[model samples]
Target: MDNDFSVDLDDILATLRSHDIVIARFVTVHRRLLFDFRSTPLDPPLVAAVDPLPSIEARYRHLRELRPRLGDPPKLVTVFWPRFVASLADTPAWQAVRGRLSASGHPGAVESADAALAGLVDLERAAQREAILGGRAFRTIWSASPSPR
Candidate 1:
């Protein structure tokens, strides 16, 4: 769907409130990869998207609250890819309240498991982030045009 991020801040919060704002984390340790999901809330609760205040601190504060929920990373006990998944699985020891889980070998999942694992390792740190931009709500700043100087 085409989202108009160009809208006012109120609209931004409205847009966020409309959907389930979540930050996803793909973590790994040893040899496992898993996906973690957290609910990101909108500030001011249910204020109708009317006039948007210049500062985003209001909305940002709510976003920051999500940090506690995100807890270090997307710490999910469920494993997606072993090794990388295991790697992700290993990081969230505290999040794993329901005892320890195991990773299943995807012997037939991919042709180059080693290459995939290497790629995951390389991307581990970089990929760790909020799911806000990951979603389509806001256009990636990098792709935005430079302002006329």
Candidate 2:
């Protein structure tokens, strides 16, 4: 004996149609920036928000390279975000690390590391500004852990 099952082709087609509609809505309403910074002319406010900051991922990578002792990119961002609550430049960890490097007499290491941290803050602010402009309330990179890509 064999069992037969009935198929609801109309139900399946309706579900597919609903998914297509959702996809179309997402594509139209949720446009992402093609580049971190605008290549074409943009609103003055947006230009001011992003143009002053270094490229997000590039800045993140540079910071990671400058501070490999801090651990991986995500870990570094997580650690740095809290320290930035009061001041971007006067992070306690930066002072300690800078002192150690200075004692070791590594020329430019402290300055480069300081610049990288400052740039990381700029990247975070830029991302926040862009998110607000896009009408997005939540974003993945709030901690400034730029995408590895």
Candidate 3:
């Protein structure tokens, strides 16, 4: 399977459409991907996309590479990747980019984030299931506790 987290734009757009989130504007500025949308054609819970988000396997490999110095590689991998997803909208990098986009009067400059995220989660769950065997694959793959010291 492809290890990269790169997602197909058309597939993602289809998922967003399925969620009934209207795409006000979707653009990539300076190679940073962003999407602007509302929960419905006219509504609240605006959302934007932020990506290059790593996959579970990629994240696991990265931590494993740290080797002897790494404390509980599986644990770190489990905690970090989900944390990365949760913190996407709050990241300073994304917030700064959002600020600039809003200042420039760009459409989809993240008013408040959500609906698209929900759809993206749905897409991610399906993809990951196919990659492994089932949902929350990380939990199964990383469930082994570190050997006792």
Candidate 4:
């Protein structure tokens, strides 16, 4: 018998578009696994999410083709494994990842891999800003506040 799992690409794409992240589950003939995408934004967050390995591979290929077409290359790419939740939680990986992403380029290109499925939403946002400012003059302004624990 063929032992393989299946995933809903549309659902995965939607989650990425909305949350910018995903933790999915997968069940094969013998075992279950998680797909996490807390590392590279170019790869789908499938380490925890239940998606067939083949499906994940296919998606990656498609995204690779789509990314540059939208605009400039993104800065950071991260992938996380749910099985190492404790290790990730205890380390500075998340902060480091965010930092890398922040430094990659403008936040305009710093979309999570999951969010990339929304058909160049980042480019659209950038275009809007360009239209308003007459150029790529934009910045992220923030108010000063104490870090919340």
* lDDT, candidates in the order shown: 0.30, 0.33, 0.37, 0.35
Give per-residue CA lDDT, model 1, range 1-149, as digits (tens). 22222324343233223332312223332222221223233211111111222344543454445344443432212212223322432333312311211112223222233344345556443343323446433246564677776
Each model's backbone clash number? 15, 0, 0, 24
Q: In terms of lDDT, which candidate is stronger, 2 or 3?
A: 3
The candidates, ranked best first by lDDT, are 3, 4, 2, 1
- Candidate 4 residue runs with Cα over 4 Å from true position: 1-57, 65-90, 108-149
Q: Compared with the true structure, what per-residue lDDT tens digits does model 4 show for residues 1-149? A: 22233334444444433343333321211122222223344532322212243565554554454343333223222232333222222334334333444544434333552233222334444555675566645454543686666
TM-score, cand. 2: 0.35
Stretches > 4 Å off in candidate 1? 1-25, 28-111, 128-149
Candidate 2: tens digits of C-alpha lDDT, residues 1-149: 11233334354334322221110011111211111111112211010111212455654564445344443333211111222212424534335445544544445545654554445556556555766665356555454566565
TM-score per candidate, in order? 0.18, 0.35, 0.27, 0.27
On a 0 to 100 scale, what is the lDDT of residue 5 in model 3?
48
Q: In model 1, state the lDDT of residue 97.
A: 14
Per-residue error at 136 for model 4, in Å? 48
> What is the C-alpha lDDT profile of model 3 across 1-149, one tens digit per residue?
32344434444334343332222222211111233222222322334433333565653453344232433222221101222242344545345434543543435544434444444545554655655764533345554688666
lDDT of 2 at 24: 8
What would you estimate as the lDDT of candidate 2? 0.33
Which window of 10 residues has the lowest lDDT sum in candidate 2? 20-29
Error of 1 at 80 (Å): 7.0
Task: Itemize residue pairs with steric clashes in candidate 2.
Answer: none
Q: Give the Å shift of residue 96 in candidate 3.
A: 1.1
